[model samples]
Target: MLVWERPEPRNRPVPAPLSRDRIVRAAIRLADADGLDAVSLRKVATALDVRPMRLYGYIDSKEELLDLMVDAAYAEILPVGDDWREVLRSLAESVRHTAHEHEWLADLLGGRPQLGPHALASGERVMAALGELGVDAVMPVTAAVNAYVIGAVRREIAERRAERTTGMDEKRWQASLGPYLRRTIATGRFPALATVVRDAAHLDADDTFRIGLDFLLDGIGARVSK
Candidate 1:
C-alpha cells in the first residue's frame, strides 16, 4: 500500500512524535549527507534515536521510504511560468537544480512512478500550464522532456561523484587525458569527435544542461507548431 494511504498516527502533531513526516525528513537528511547507499532504515532509526522495529509503524519498507524521500524532494520544484515552453523549461531546470542540492535524488528520479501528493501536484501544475496543447501531445511531449531531465541529472551527478572520487575537477581531469586523447585523435579514427573535443566550447555543466534543455524546448515548440 502507498504510504500516503496509511493513517497517520494520533501523535503526529504532538511534540517529538514518531510520524511518517519525521521519518521521511530524517531519511532525507541521511541521504543528503551520505548519498542514497548510506541511507538504510536502521540508519534512519538511529538518526531518530528509535529502535529499528519501531519504524515499521510509520513505513513498511525501504522502498516506501525512498518514495517518501523523492516526494519530499519534489517539494523543492516550485511552480513555473505560464507559457508551456517556460513551464517545461523551468520544470526541467528546477529538477536538475534540486538534484544538485540533494545529489542522492538523481538515483531515484524518473526511475519510479512518483504517486506521492507533492509529485502529483507538480504534474497537475505542468498539465494545467500545457492546457493549450492538444491533450494527446501533453503526455508524450512532456514525457520527452522528463526523460531528458532524468538522463541529464544522472549524468551530472555521475560526473560529480567521479570528480569527488578522483580528486580532480573536470577541467584538470580532461587535461590529464590530453596526451592519450591527442594520441588517439592522431590516428584519424574519430576526426569529427576529435574536432569537437578540440574546438567545442566545452561549456560548464550548467550551460550544457541549459543548452540541451533549450534544444528540447525548441523541439517541443516546433512539434506543437506543426
Candidate 2:
C-alpha cells in the first residue's frame, strides 16, 4: 500500500513594497557605512524591512546592485560650466569628492564597464566638453582624464583604508618605518629615491591629487596648443 498526501503550504512573511530606486539607495547606505563588502542583498533587505527574496524582483545580484549604486552616484555629479578646462577640472574634483564621501566608489570605479544611463550621461558630458575644445581624438582625451582621476582617487582611498586599519597616519607610519628606510638609504645604491625620501615635501593627499591633476592637464594643454 502507498500513501499520497499533499504537503501543507508553509507561511512566508509578506514583503513590503520595494522599488529599484529604494533598493539601490538602501544598498548605497550600507556601503557608505561599512564599505562595499557590507552591501549584500540580505543586508539591504534587512535595511528595507523586506524579505531577501523580494529584493530579487528589484535587483538580480550584488553586482547589479553595485552598478545601480554607481549610476546613482554619477547622477549626483551635475554638469559644470562650458569651458573645457574648467569642465574637466570641475569633473575631476567632483569625482574625487564623491569618492571620498563614498569610499567604496574608488574600488568599483574603472574596475568595470559602466553602461548605466547615468554613467553614460556622465561620459557624454565629458565628451561634449572635449568636443567644444576641438579635441581631435575625443575618446583618448576623455580616457586620459578618466584614467588620471580614477587612479588618483583609488590611491587616496587605499591610503585612507591603510591608515584606518593600521591606526596611523602617513607621517606616523613613515616614522615607524624610519629605521629601516634610513638603513636602506644609507646603502648609497638608490640615490634618486634616497633624495626623494629625504627631501620630498609632504603634501597631504588632497594637495597631491590636485597637483598631479594640474600637471597632467598642463601636458594636455601643451599638446592641444601645439
Candidate 3:
C-alpha cells in the first residue's frame, strides 16, 4: 500500500534569528528610549520582529535580561591606572557618565549582586586599586564606594526625572516652594536648614555630583591614610 500522506506540518512560524546580544540590545534600547518599565519580553520581541516565546530561547526571564543589560553598561567602564584614588575616581566618574547616557542604569545599580563577567571585572578593578592602598577590610571599602556611587547617581537621575515631569529645574522647583519654605524657616524650627538653604550657593547638578564624589573619596582617603 502507498504510504499515508505525510502528517500536516506544524503551523508554528519560523522564529527570527535571535541571540542573547540581540535580545539584550533591543531591551536596552527600549529602556533607554522609555524607562526600565518598558522593557518586557513581549515588547522587546515585537521590537525585534519575533515571537515573545523566541526570547525565552536566549533569555530565561526578564530578570536575566536586566542582569545582562547592567553587565553591558558595566562593560563600557574600562579600568584606569593602578593608583587607588585615581582608579576609584575614574571608575566613579565612568559610572556616572554611563548612568547619564543610559538613565535606566542608575536604577539597576546596587539593585542586586552584580555577578556578570563585566560587572565582576569592573568590581575587581576597584578592589585591585584598593588592595594597592593596603586598606583593611577591602569588602567594606568596596561596599562604601559602591554605596556612594549608587546613591549619588540615583539622586542625580531622580532629580532629572523630576525636572522632566514638572517642566522645572531645581531652582524653579525650589522657587515654587519658596513661600512655604520661608514660612517654615521663620518659625525657627530648623535654623540650620534655613541658613544653609538661604545662604548657600545652589550647586548645579554636575557640581553637586562632583562635590559629593570628592567628599566620599575624602572619607575613604582618611581611612586609608590612618
Evaluated with lDDT, which candidate comes out highest?
Answer: 1
lDDT of each: 0.89, 0.81, 0.83
* Tens digit of per-residue lDDT, candidate 2, span 1-226: 1001222224345556667878889989999999988989999989999889877655557777888899889987665766778778888998988889999998888877777778778877887888855867576777788899999888888988988998999779888999998998899999999989779997887788889889988888888877
Question: Can you tell me which runs of candidate 3 are displaced by over 4 Å?
Answer: 1-15
Per residue, candidate 1 scores C-alpha lDDT tens digits across 14-99 of 33459888899998898899988888999998998878888898888999999999999999997689689888988998998899
Best by TM-score: 1
Error of 1 at 181 (Å): 0.8
Q: What is the lDDT of residue 112 in candidate 3?
A: 70
Instruction: Quote the lDDT for 73 in model 3.
Output: 93
lDDT at position 79, candidate 1 = 61
TM-score of each: 0.94, 0.87, 0.87
Of the pair 1 and 3, which is ahead by TM-score?
1
The better candidate by TM-score, 1 or 2, is 1
Distance (Å) between predicted and true CA of 171, model 1? 2.5
Residue 212, candidate 1: alpha-carbon lDDT: 92
Sorted on lDDT, best first, the list reads: 1, 3, 2
Residue pairs with backbone atoms closer than 3 Å in model 2 (clashes):
none
**Each model's RMSD to truth, in Å?**
1.8, 8.5, 8.2
Candidate 3 lDDT, tens digit per residue, 8-96? Answer: 22334555667777888999999999999999999999999988987776667888889889999999986697587788788888999
Clashing pairs in 1: none
